[model samples]
Target: MSAVDVSLRRGEREILHGVDFAVRTGEIVALVGPNGAGKSTLLAAMSGDHPISGGRVEIDGRPLDRWSPIALARRRAVLPQQHSVGFPFTARQVVRMGRAAWARTPRQDDDDRIVAEALTTCDVEHLAERPFPSLSGGERARVALARVLAQDTETLLLDEPTAAMDLGHQEEIMQVVRARADDGHAVVVVLHDLGLAAAYADRICVLEQGHLVADGAPDDVLGEELLGRVYRYPVTIGRHPETDTALVLPRRPSRASSPSAQP
Candidate 1:
């Protein structure tokens, strides 16, 4: 999927400012930035959920608006920042909804098998029979991801998928995301956790004030200097001792000198 010079507006307010981005198949691009930097807005535009006032979004070289809704659903799936189910739907039932796009097709017959596989892949098989509303936040997050995976689309746009998940679950979710990209899927995810982005993202796009400021490999784009400047806090970037993945941490502020010690 590619977004060229994309600009989105709501009334007189502009959310995204001519942002240009593309993610090739088999790539995982993490969008990282301070809050309100337009990361989610960009994802919404690329997913065709929000209209663009200028520029264009294309999938397979065709404009997003030109593709039929059902046809486009088969090529891309979006997991937004907030996922809600109003009814008392079980996890299995919720995931089965992902197959709605295939209704009336021969593939519809495979919905059961696909939903089960998606549940297991997302580590939510054990929660299959549980009511979605009864699950914890982390459990709900995993179930939501299972629903997305069941769609089985080639391109995925995820918005802060790890939100409300525990540390172990967060890592597990990111591992699942990376595995999908490795399987030749194009994955673009919004991430507030710089450490997680550094660890799992093949590429990082840094946005600041609705502008794409930096884009490159994780190590190159997530340098301590750049992070301190963008995030407005001292940070240190290091390599994990065992896996050698990028590790990011905030530096503690130094204590101010006492009046007696001052010159």
Candidate 2:
């Protein structure tokens, strides 16, 4: 998916200004910035869920508005920040819903196997029979991801997919995303964890105050000065000893002392 000169507005309020972004097949692009940055809005605009006041979103060299809803669903799947199920449904059922977009098509024949694979891939197989509403936040997040995976689209747009997970699961989820990208899927994920972005994203786009400030490889884009300025906080960037990934941390004294830091 690609967006050119995209601008988003809401009730006379401009949220994004002339953002240009594109994700090629088999690549992962991460959107990163401080709170209220236009990352999510840009993603939504790319997905056609949010209207753009200017510019266009294109898929396969065609304008997004030109595609039918089902055709669009077949090309790209979106995982928003929140996961919710109004009805009482099992995890597997929630995933099956992903295939609804393929109903009446030949792809529907693969629904069962794909759903199972998605459940296992997201590590939600054990919870497949559990009620979605009954699962923990992280579990629900995984199930939600499974649903998106089951959709089986080439382009995946995810928003803060690890926000509710523990460290291990966070890494595991990104690993899934990385593997997906390696398998020729296009992925765009919004992430607050610069370390995760640095570790897994092929490129990181840094946004600040509704503008695209930087867009490039993690190593090229995640400099200490740029991050500190965009995040409006002191930060330091280093290389991870084991993985050689960027290690970003707030520049604060180890014992510096806030009541919030106290257990």
Candidate 3:
């Protein structure tokens, strides 16, 4: 999937301004920025859930509007930031819902196997029997992700997939994403955690107030000056001692200088 010069406006205000982005097979692209930076809006636009006032979204060189809803669902799947259901649906039922796009098609035959695998892959096999509403925040997040995985599309668009998870689950989710990318699927994830993005993303796109400021490898784009300016805080880049990934941390004031630490 690709977007060229994409722009979005809402109720007299422009949210995104000519942002150019694309994700290819075997690649993991991360979108990172502060609150209201248009990350979720951009992802929604990509998935055809939101309207774009200017520019176009394309899949396989064809405009997004040209494809039927089911046809597009077969090619790409989107996992939105919120997953809510009015009915009492079990986690397994929810995951199986992902295969609805192929209901009458030949691929429908594989629904059982695919849903089972998705549940297992997301580490939600145990929760599969429980009502989705009864699951914890982290468990619900994983089940939602399994639904997306079961969609079995070439490209996956995720919005804050780990926002509710613990440290271990966050790493596990990113690892699953990494495996997906390695298996030749395109992955685009919106992440508030810069450290997580820097650790797993092949490329990072930085947005500040809806404008695309930088797009490149994490090491190139996540510098002290740019991050500090965009996030409005002092940051220092360091290396992880174990994984050796780029580590982004706030440059906090010293104890003697900190307001909270004053004697």
Candidate 4:
């Protein structure tokens, strides 16, 4: 999927300012920026959920408007930032809903198998029988991810898939994303954790105040000076001992210089 010079307006205020972004097959592109930096807005535009006042979104070399809803759903799946299920449904049932787009099609017969595979891939198979609402935040996040995976689309647009999870689950979700990208799927994820983005993502795109500031491989785009300016805080980047990838950490003020230590 590709968003060419996309600009989106919410009412009178514009959220995204002509951002050009794309996620190619077999690539995991991580969108990283500070809060209110228009990451989610860009993702919405890419998914066709929000209207763009200017520019176009294309899928498989065709404009987003040219494809039918079901046809689009068959090619790409979006997991929005806010996913809530009002109905009382079990995890399995919730996941099965992803196959709705394929209903009445030949793939309908493979629903059960596909859903099960998605559940296991997301590490939520154990929660398959549990009520979605009753599950904990992390569990719900995983189950929601499973639903998206069950859609079996070639492109996966995930918005903070690990926001509510613990460290273990966070790593698990990243692994799932990594596997998907390795499997020749296009994956775009919004992440606040720069370390994970550097470690797992093939490319990183930085946005500030709705503008695309930088876009490149992790080593090229995740520089300390650039990130500090974008995040409005000092940062330090180092190489991981084992992986040799960039490891990003905030530079905190020392106690002697901190405000709390002032007279």
Candidate 5:
């Protein structure tokens, strides 16, 4: 899937400038940026959830608008930052909804198998019968993820999927994302954790104020200069001694030394 000169505008305010990027099959790309930088907005546009004011988005060389809604849902699945059904639904029922895109025939056994597999893949099999609204934040997040997994789309777009999870759960989610990419699906995720992005993403695209600032390998895009410039903070980028992955740490101002003391 690819974005071809995609630009989105909400009224007079533009959310995404003429941004161009692509996700090759079997690769994972992470969109990293500060708040209001249009990371989520860009994903929404690419997933056909938001309309573009200029340019067009194409999936497999075909314009997004040309595909039927069911066809689009089958090819690409999106998990927004927040989801709510506003009613009590069993986790299994919620997951079954993902199969609606392909449920042309009455096949209960197939649906059950798909839902079970999705729950197991997401490590939420125990919560399958629980009501979605009654589950904890992390559990609910996992259930939501399982729904997307059940969709079995070739392209997956996730926005801040690990925000409500703990460290362990966060790592688990990243593992799931990486596994999906390894299975030849294009995966694009908006991640706030720089370390996770560096570890999991094959490429990192940094957005700044609705503009595509940097698009390259994580080592190049997550440098100290880019962090300090785009995030407005002094940050140090170093390699993890054990895992050999990139690590980012914010540099604190020295209390003993005043800014005026420097020549």
Candidate 6:
């Protein structure tokens, strides 16, 4: 079964213009771009949360619309950029909800086991009994992630999962995501931190103003020239001394010469 094909559009907007990409088994693809670049829109379309105005989204070589809601939930898990629960629910209760895809009768011991593993994986075991609303932003983010992890789907889609996290928590989340990819799950993450993307992503997909400007390995996609064109700023790209990964540094925008100074 192929991973999936995700595309979307809006009236006259055309958020995603037939963006074609694939996620192989056991690979982590990071989608990076500036604001309003359609990163979140693409993720929404892929997760079945948003209707595609034109093209379709597929999973395992079949159209996503063909799968029943529960079937799709069982096959793919999504952690959105924002998660809020108005109803007061304990963290454990919320995390357990991820198992809803598999809960045909009642909560089984296997569900508890998976929830425990997910909580530990996301470092939220200590907060399992706390109310979801009482936890800090970072803690709540971790709990939200734990919920998705508990789903135990073959594919995971995350949108800015670490945006509200601390450095340590960010590392923890990235580590868990990388481990998931290593375990043969197709993982897609929308990351604002290019450094983190470079460190963890198997490939980087760059978007600019709702268009896919570049899609390739970090070395090729994150070149200085491409970065400058997409971001409209001067930038430098070099290899990290410690990790040998691509490092990007933004420079001041170059000034345009006046018409009279064209020579």
Better of 4 and 5 by lDDT: 4
Summarize candidate 1's per-residue lDDT along 1-263 as a digit string, tens digits.
99999988989988888999999999999999999889999999999999999999999999999999999999999998887889999999999989999999999999999999989988999999999999998888889899999998999999999988999989999999999999999999999998899888889999887889899999889898888888888899888898787888898645555565566
Angstrom error of the Cα, residue 248, model 5: value is: 1.0
Model 3's lDDT to the true fold?
0.95
What's the ranking of the predictions by TM-score, best on top? 3, 2, 4, 1, 5, 6
lDDT string for model 5 (109-141, tens) is: 488788999899888999988889999888888
The Cα RMSD of model 1 versus the native structure comes to 2.7
Predicted structure 5, TM vs. truth: 0.94
Best candidate according to TM-score: 3
lDDT of 6 by residue, 1-263 (tens): 23233446676667777677677779999999888889899888888898886666778778878999988988999999888998889999999999998877463558989999999999999999999999999999999999999999999999999999999999889999999999999999999888899999999999887677788888878888888887778788878899999888887444555565566
Task: State in Å the error of residue 228, model 1.
Answer: 1.4
Evaluated at residue 167, the lDDT of candidate 2 is 97
Stretches of candidate 3 exceeding 4 Å from the true structure: 259-263
Q: Which stretches of candidate 1 lie over 4 Å from their true place?
A: 254-263
Deviating ranges (above 4 Å) for candidate 2: 256-263
Which of 2 and 5 is ahead in TM-score? 2
Encode model 4's per-residue lDDT on 137-201: one tens digit a residue: 88898999999999999999999999999999899899999999999999999999898999899
Off by over 4 Å in 5: 105-109, 254-263
Span of 10 residues, lowest total lDDT, candidate 6: 1-10
C-alpha positional error of residue 56 in candidate 1 after TM-score superposition, expressed in Å: 0.3
Give the runs in model 4 whose Cα sits over 4 Å from its true position: 255-263
TM-score of each: 0.94, 0.96, 0.97, 0.96, 0.94, 0.91
What do the candidate models score in CA lDDT, each in turn? 0.92, 0.95, 0.95, 0.93, 0.90, 0.86
Compose the digit string of candidate 2's lDDT tens values, residues 57-125: 999989999999999999999999999999989999999999989999998999999999999998999
Candidate 2 CA-lDDT value: 0.95
lDDT of 5 at 138: 82
